[model samples]
Target: LGRIQIKKTDGTLILNSLNASDSNASIKGLEFDKSLIKYQMYYSGNAECNDKGYVYLFFPDPNNLNQMKLTFMQEPDIIVSCPSGYKTL
Candidate 1:
């Protein structure tokens, strides 16, 4: 599992890795809105095999009730690698 912390004042992002085996974790890009108090982060490197993808973290303005809704734009793709004749479900 992973943990993310955002500083409200300056939109600073903090990523915490709980597992000892995790490495090379980082944030690739970030978009922050000071006025709306919202942010989107593109991150990668949480997997053991150096998988590439985006981990988006969104924070909406607390005052706006409608903006508080969460939405999933798309389903994540899962990839696995193994020796020949090995089956994965």
Candidate 2:
């Protein structure tokens, strides 16, 4: 892996590669609110935001990734903003 490349999708790159395979990758933390609703079809996972005429999501680097259950699951790349705004569609 000796090339700088980009993986564009849904406004965010699910996986970014470094020039070298050993290079480190940074994935931010994700927080889900109890009031937030989850709309899988819209990739919206915040009930609070959903009820507030908005939606949000984050690709958090779960501190305990090992504890995560990933069984052929594909997560969303674009983390919604918040009870920030409503989706047109």
TM-score of 2: 0.18
- Candidate 2 Cα lDDT to native: 0.32
Top candidate (TM-score): 1
State how far residue 28 of model 2 sits from its true place (Å).
2.5
Q: Go through the candidates in order and give each one's C-alpha lDDT.
A: 0.43, 0.32
Compute each candidate's TM-score over C-alphas.
Answer: 0.30, 0.18
Model 2 segments more than 4 A misplaced: 1-15, 18-23, 38-89
Q: Write the per-residue lDDT of candidate 1 for residues 1-89, one digit (tens) a residue.
A: 33334344676644344333434434444565575454544445433333334444454556655644322223255545534553211
